[model samples]
Target: MQDITFKHTLPVQLRFNDIDALGHVNNSVYFTFYDLGKARYFEEVKRSPINWNDADLVIANVNANFLSPVFMSESIAVQTATLSIGNKSLKVVQRIINTDTKEVKATCETILVGFDVATSSAKEISVEWKEAISFYEGRELCK
Candidate 1:
């Protein structure tokens, strides 16, 4: 897995609707925080030759494992990391944490496939994308 870490401080306000009568954040709401993290990451990654608005990649699959529940009032943040880079696709690993207590609340991994928009077919992930992700990872090259 090619690992890279990116940080996004998810606001509690964004999760306001997640509070249940039981007084804990709903399990289903974790995905929303993951979505916010990915959005921030895309902004950072697309500042190069890749057109942020015109990218041909889309999420083909995603998986999440909830380790714990978060409370509504707690400060939270979602940290995203790349787990793998493939020929025509990539996978991202995400962790939702309680920033105040430094506790991990959930983990997720998403697979994104690069597609040729015109042909509607899978395409090889560009080297530039790999390089940018690698540099952000601050580790040895992924491939």
Candidate 2:
């Protein structure tokens, strides 16, 4: 994981509701941090506003590993990067980290497919999207 470089990071705001009875952040809340990172990454890379009503991509799957517990006293951030792009889908990876300590609290990988809401079907990844991501990452991606 240390070899992978992330170009985007979004600070996560902790809310009282995010905590559980165990006195730590609830596991489910990490997804929201990843969502924030994803949204910001797309907004920067695509250089276009994302319309959720007609989102360009839809999450097909998400896998996360909780490395450590997050307490309310710690400041956190989510780092994101595009892992790979396929013909009709892409993989994104994110890490939730303690900002001050630089300790990763959780890591996640999400698979997303280009989607068409009108038809409720998958679509091929656009050349523009691939280009944008590649340009942002400063490397060639997608086979």
Question: Which candidate number would show the highest lDDT if scored against the true structure?
Answer: 2
TM-score of each: 0.82, 0.96
lDDT value for model 1:
0.74
Candidate 2 residue lDDT tens string, 1-143: 54689999998889999999999999998888888899999999988778789887999999999999999999999999998999999999999989999999999999999988899999998898999999999988797
Clashing residue pairs in candidate 2 are none
Lowest-sum lDDT 10-residue window in model 2: 1-10
- How many residue pairs clash in all the candidates, one count each? 0, 0
Query: Which candidate should be chosen as best, given TM-score against the real structure?
Result: 2
- Give lDDT: candidate 2, residue 12: 87
